[model samples]
Target: MNETRERIALLSKALDLMTDRPIRVMEVCGTHTVSIFRQGLRSLFPPSLELVSGPGCPVCVTDQGEIDAAVSLAGIKGVTVATYGDMLRVPGSGSSLVNERALGRDVRVITSADQALEIARNEKTRLVVFVAVGFETTAPSTASVILDAHREGRGNFTVLNLHKAVPPVLEALASDKNIALDALLLPGHVSVILGLSPYRFLPEDHGIACAVAGFGAEDIMLALVEVVRQIREGRPRVASLYSQAVREEGNCLARDLIDRVFEPCDSSWRGLGNLPLSGYGLREEYSSIDALKRLEISINDTSPPSGCSCGEVLKGKMLPRECALFGRLCNPSHPVGPCMVSSEGSCAAHFRFSRGGDHPWKH
Candidate 1:
């Protein structure tokens, strides 16, 4: 514990030394956002350095159209929708999975993709559709389960693949002029799977300093220090500070599993609209278990609530507190948006940990 504090103090001093000017850094992982706030790391940064949250929460980023589609899927007769628990309360155009479940629709919260497959194996008469939503970190597990279902001839098993690739979305964010980010604290979990190769574009193409960081205070501080150091040196590049978990080459086996079962496709985000080649679709070989193909479900684009600024929050354009609905009409108990509904969401994290404003340490 003492060593962690000393390391953080050194990193904080390093950050203070390098941050001569205002630097806006976005932590592109929901877990990072929560960790920053939970550990009071937001207060440790230099006054010139600002940390913002990005579209890192999978539940928060799952488009309203996709949510509505999943809700619609749940209402279908003989169809059982299996999804992560965080997705249960995310509002759709009209209803959520939880609401549908209450309305007698068979929507079940699953801890793993394999559970959905097991449900399919047990209930042969019913169609079991797993709503797969995550970044590259979780996609390999979902892919593995899909393959298992295919091999076991679980004809009733299918997956609504809302799994998104992180690189394309990061490219989109890097190109956006409005954000004008100086650096990025990359997701450690996703980086463990993708390695450092996929993120080279951030520094090479956009001139943004980025570093892969873990959830711990020391790990995040090390990454932040590296980012500030890169900025100070005028040599913006991608660095892996969380080398214990992340590698330069990433996990080849996991990538192989993802590639074997899924193909790149255009995907829509909550705020970022449709990004090219940003989502994963099951490959032709896995069409038998592709929920959209097998179930013939249509997904129509839907807008957010009238007063919710969840989209702005997801894009790092607006803070969670800036939204009028935050902590007022939209608490975790009665969420007005996905950002409030999701545990890893920026709004939820802010609501739980933040006292008033951006400066949590002050309060």
Candidate 2:
């Protein structure tokens, strides 16, 4: 614990020395958002150093059109929609998976893609469609399940592929002139698959400092200090602070599996709009398991909630509380937007930890 305090003090000193302007470091990982809140790391920062949440939460950034497509599949007579629990309460255009489930639609909350595959194997008559949503970290697991289904000839199984790539979106964010970001805290889990190579573009191309960070408070603090140090030295570079789990080349086998099963495609983000080559679709070889093709589902372009500023929040342009309906209308119990529905969401993090105006940044 003393070691933790010492690290915090060092990071604080670095920020105090380097932060002449508001240095906005966005953490592009939902787990990081939760960890920052849980560890009270935001409060430890100097006033000039600000921690902002980005479109890191897969569930939170999932476009409404995709959610509607999943809900539509759930309502089908012989189809069962399987998804992670975080996606249950997220409202679609008119209805959510939870509401559909309550109305007797077959929507099962699953922990992993393998569980959804097992459901397909057990229920021969019912078509199981797994809502495959995540970054590279979870995409390989989904790819593994798809490979297994293909090998076993599990004709009943299909995947609604909503998997996104982190690096592409990061490039898009960096290119955007509206988001004045100083540094990036990359997702450790995603880095475990992509390695440090994918994030090199941020530092090399955009002159932004980045650190692949772990979830612990000490890990985050150490990463923050490194980012500040890079800025202080006038040398922005990508550094891996979570070297224990992530590597420079990442997991070659996992990346190979993902490449084998999926192909890059243009994908729409909640706030960022359609980014080029930001999403993954099942490869033609696995088209038999591609739910969108098999079910003839079309994802219509949809807008966010009427008054929700989730898009701005996801882009780090606005804080969760800066939204007009953050707590008054969009609480966890009754979420008006995806940002409030997912536990890793920025709005949910703010609601859970800073609703009482205790967040140091609010001052």
Candidate 3:
């Protein structure tokens, strides 16, 4: 048989080997979340195997106060906002960055944090503010830009520090007994930066097998197979199925840059409450450029639209439909929370495919 057929056969065999009649595994990456839904992968897999999404999408999990802060910053004269393509659409207190952009405000889309520094250096009149988002995968890049800005003396450039660490969030999830995940399909993007060295601690320390897997349909299927296989064979360990990107030591330069630019700070997740040392803050020397340090804004913490269960969804506790606004009121166009706004969010994926229909299996 061909390689494709061989892979499928392996997956089928792996599923058959699962102990205690199948298991539940979570894809902790947002890209994986969207890809799984878009490819209609669930219908292809056995009903016994389940794939639940986690807080892999940074934009989706970013607290509502952050969205509001970004919109509030948008109105400041001579302040230029730079962010990934994802944050442009997320609504903040009835207004998204895009809505603010419609009123002729300055909002720039940047691939790397260095690009924002370049703009800040050249445009002396504009205060270049990078809307820093993402987990370990994207955080290193932001760290690189911050170090470069400080080294080059680019004072006009500052980041709205919303960067988060991966492992702590994982710990928070694992500590919660309610999750009951048999194994975890770790994020590929974050693994590319941080590598599998630190993740060895997950299995050794947390007693959970973390398979660093790719985001494609076939990649995820293979990961699920391996995860199930490990449990059945009575072997729990951290392994990399997507060796093309992930390594043991990870990217050293990226890690060094992240270390130099920022320090660990207490971070609050949308679903999981405040996690100690889960977020990043600008270092003391770089504090001059940090917007949070520069401008003081009164942030009022409010519940997400009363019954909106976006937080619970981020934690994988509830499905998208569990929320009253899932399809009726909350959607890509008119999002009640960040989950609906972000393309990688679980709610967006379910709304896009699972809506006007039902899942083939009973969860």
Candidate 4:
């Protein structure tokens, strides 16, 4: 639309104003990744401005261990594992949730968290475990579902809380010396719950510029403008361009709901190693609903297969093509890592939008 074009123009002007040095701005949202590529965002920027994808995609960042845990739950008799459609194909220990779903396992893909609650209510005999994966955006809904189930006395409903917090991963990335990021475009949806306040550490502590960005061409463009302006001014502070949704405190009610029902635990991510307090777990009172507890499943807790550079890609040290399996073996049809399976995946976005073309940053 006209709005998209105007935003693109604004983004170009912002990049033009960045006459100091190469500005490495990363979009920290999966939806932003798809939008950036689908709208040809890189094409709009000059060689001086480089936009990198970050560990923003919840499905992509959902650790292999978590998937393995989910798969193990599917292995249990009379236990149904429900998840989003995007998570079905994500590989987990040489197998996938999709393949397991096809093998007549009780794995159902639901659109919303409430649907999982419904399944639990209807199938009282079957233990329904919703594989909850996402950041603040989806966490609220998952928390709401857990609250609803408890209020309605649906004892069969349990959530395998693989929900991840963004700040830890961001901190991990910032501390790693391999990456040379100048600024980050934070995920708009996540800012809705955790808010831009949590991002204070990145700018204040780390001296990295971060702009909270909204999804869509216009929104992304505006975020770029903010990032560029901040860098140009030499002021590394967190700015919220998605003010329509994100706030400094975020949705406190939703956050309280999650805090009440779940507790933070050291969880692993696909590319990122074990981070402190990155994962959430259901409260002990809800242990009966905890599928892993009820089913008595243990995660394999193994490392990635040899020669997979998913860790490098997740750390923002390597691009998708840098991985051996990227295009040759890991296509959309056959994904080796979570980064290639999901639409917002870095590999998927690049292959879908930038492959076979000379990237502006390359020249």
Q: Going through the candidates in order, what is the number of backbone clashes in each? A: 0, 0, 0, 0
Relative to the unseen true structure, what is the C-alpha lDDT of residue 115 in candidate 2, on a scale of 0 to 100?
Answer: 99
lDDT of each: 0.90, 0.90, 0.81, 0.81
TM-score of each: 0.96, 0.96, 0.92, 0.93
Look at candidate 1 and give me any clashing residue pairs: none
lDDT of 2: 0.90
TM-score for candidate 1: 0.96
Per-residue CA lDDT of candidate 4, range 1-363, in tens?
565566567667766766467878777788888888886666777678888788888888877777888887887788888999889988888678888888889899899999999998888999898999998788889988888888888878887888888888898888876677888988888888887678899988877888888777777777777777887888899988888788789989988988888888888887777899987777887777776776777665777756677677766778888887778888888788778888888888887887656643322
Winner on TM-score (3 vs 4): 4
Q: After superposition, how far is residue 26 of candidate 1 from its true place, in Å?
A: 0.6
Task: TM-score for candidate 4, please give it.
Answer: 0.93
Across 278-334, the per-residue lDDT of candidate 2 in tens digits comes to 999888999999898899998989988899999899999999998999898889999
Q: List the residue pairs that clash in candidate 4.
A: none
